[model samples]
Structure formats: structure tokens, C-alpha cells
Target: MSILSLQGVVAGYGSAPILNGLDLALDEGDIGVIVGPNGAGKSTTLKAVFGLLAVSDGCILLRGEDIANRPTESHAGRGLAFVPQEHNVFRTLSVQENLDMGAYVRRGERAALLDRVFEIFPPLKAKRAQPAGELSGGQRQMVAVGRALMSDPSVLLLDEPTAGLSPLYMSELFDRVVAVNRTGVTVALVEQNARQALGIATRGFVLAGGRMRFTGTGAELLADPDVARSFLGG
Candidate 1:
């Protein structure tokens, strides 16, 4: 069964709707990528699922349980984590401090949790004492993702994780994401680099105008000429 599923979900800003009956499903241990142009409601989908936006219609389930309209704080303990594209890290805090915040909900085993995150982001381990704002963009992104992982979530929701970074860092970022997936975490990611994102994804979801344009395996969508011409920059 899917770890996360959205069915006919409708949401918007104060009644000005953005998502119109969109549907998506993410399975356990799968890397699902959502890609489309700007205003395609890519980030909005993550927000809606994370309870940042009101759900005007439809259902969002976590392992078959309705999570629609739940509070953001209520989600953390339920094995859900979200890393937004911008302002993801606590700039004022040190690297280690930001990660520590992620584990506040989990009172015990804090030491082991820190070790797990540091292992994944070695650079973060080296710069644990440095202020998060002093780090480069890519490092900050790593901290953002690492903080989310600190919660030990079952399903991770990433919003434009590779938004702005050098190609080197971007490649490394995706590698870490894949590594995380390998360890049994389900991932739903929003990305602008459709080619690279879809390349690693087990499943691809093409969002356009707040609705899904296509749903299939990564290879299948990449092979589709129409998908290539439109979303793949052909």
C-alpha cells in the first residue's frame, strides 16, 4: 500500500483555488518526483499535504488514515517531514543547533539521531559549530534536509531541494536523497530539474495547472515524446 496518497484534492488561497482535483500516490521506499513549470502548483502540493494550506476538498492519507487539514506540528510525530525550498534552515542557529531542533519532539536517543544525520552530511559534521547562515547555499540546503531527517520520518516531503546550487552540489544532493530512500524512507520531491529528478525517481508525477498531466515510472515518462517535448525541454 502507498505511504502517502492524495485523491481529488482541492485547495487554494482564501478560496482562489490552485489545485483542482489533483491525485498522487507515493509508495514506501520509493522516490517520487513531481515536476512542472512555474505556477504549476508544485510547491503548493507539498504545502497542502503538510497542512500549510486549507484543503477545500478531497482526502490526504498517511497509510490509509485521513490526514487532511491536520496541523503541521501534528505531522512530525506521525513520520512525516517537509523541507521547503526557501528559508528552510534556522539561519541564526549553528548547524548542530538547527539539527537539534528537529529532534525536540523525540525526547530520547538524541545522541544516536545526531550521529545518523552527521553521517549523511559529513560537511555538516565538520561544521557543526558554524552558524548556518555562514555556510554556502548548498551546505544550507543540506542542513535543511538533514534537519528534516533528524525526525526519523517514514515519508519525507522535499520542496525544490535543489533549487539553486552548482551542478556538483546538485548531483551530490540527489545522491544523498537516493541514499536516504535506500534505507526504507519514502520520498516525495518537487523539482525543477525534471530530467535529473525523474532519472532517480522510481515514479514520476507531471503536474500542470495544479493537476497531474501524467503518472508513470520514471523511464516510461522519459520515453514519452510528448512528455519530452513539453516538460523535458525538447
Candidate 2:
């Protein structure tokens, strides 16, 4: 069964709807990448699923349960984790402390999860005591991702995880995203770097005008002439 799915999800800020009947799904071990033009509702889709935005229509399913419009605070207990593009980490907090905060919803120990995050991002382990703000952009992104991983979520949602970074760092962060997926957590991410993002996607979605225009394997979307000409910067 698909671990996470959105069916005709309509959501937006107040009166203006950004996602118009968006449909998406991800199975276990799938790396689902969403790519689109500006205002295509890519980031809003993540927000809708994580309860950051209210769903005015349709349903969001987590393992077959309809969770549309569920309270954001309750999403964590349902095994959903989201990492936004900016200001995701507490600048004043040490790296380890930020990670610990992600575990606030949990009841038991988090050592193993912390170790796994460190394993995925070795740089975080070395800088465990440093304030998140002191790190470079790429390192701070790592910390944000590491913090979300502390929740041991069934599905991970990321919005523009590679925004504003050197090419080398962007590549490295994608590698880390793949590492996170390999550990059996389903991942759904919206990315501005369409070409590179789709290259690693198990499932690729192309959004335009707040709806899915195309859905296929990453390779398929990359090879499609229309997708290339329209959205992939032909």
C-alpha cells in the first residue's frame, strides 16, 4: 500500500487556493520528487499534507487513513515529518539540541535515531556542539534534516531542501536525501532543481497551475520532450 497519498487536495492561504485538486502518492522506499514553475503549488502541497495549510477540499491519506485538515500538532504523532526550506533550525541552539527538539513528541529514548541521523550526515556529528547558525548553509540544511529524522517518521516531507547552495553542496545534499530514503522512510520533496532532483526520483510529478500535469518515473519525465520544453528549461 502507498505509505502516503493525497487525493484531490485543495488548499491555500485563507481565500486563495494554491493547490487545486492535487493528486499524489508514495509507496514505501519511494523517493517522490515534485517539480514545477513558480506558484505551481509545489511547496503548498507539502504544507497541506503536514497541516501547515488547511484543506478546503479532498482528502489526504496516511496509510489509508483520511487525515485532511488534521491539526498540525497532531501530525507528528501520526508519523509525519516536514522540513521547510528556510529557518528550519534554531540558530541559537546547538546541533544536538535542535535534534533533541524534534524528538519532543516522542515518549522514549532517541539515541538510535540520533545515531542514524549522524550516520547519514557525518558532518553533523563533528559539529554536534556548535550553534546551528554558525554553520554554513549546507551544514545547516543537514541539521534541519537531521532534526526531522529524530522523529522516526513513516514519511518525510521536504520543501526546497537545496535552495541557495553551491553546486557541490546541492549534489551532496541530494546524496544525503538518497541515504535517508535507503533507510526505508518514504520521502516526498519539492525541488527547484528539476533536472537533478528528477534524476534521483523513483516517482516524479510535474505540476503546473496547481495541478499535476505529468506523473511518471524520474527518467520518464526527464526524457519527455514536452516536460523538457515546458518545465525543464528547454
- Candidate number achieving the greatest lDDT relative to the actual structure: 2
Cα error, candidate 2, residue 46 (Å): 0.4
lDDT by residue (tens digit), candidate 2, 74-116? 9888989999998899999999999999998764859888889
lDDT of each: 0.92, 0.94
TM-score of each: 0.98, 0.98
Error of 1 at 111 (Å): 1.5
lDDT of 1 by residue, 71-190 (tens): 989999999999999999999999989999999877596888788888778899999999999999999999998888888899999999998899999999999999888768899999
- How displaced is residue 98 in candidate 1, in Å? 0.5
Which residue segments of model 1 deviate by more than 4 Å?
none
RMSD of each: 0.9, 0.9
Which ranges in model 2 have alpha carbons more than 4 Å from their true place? none
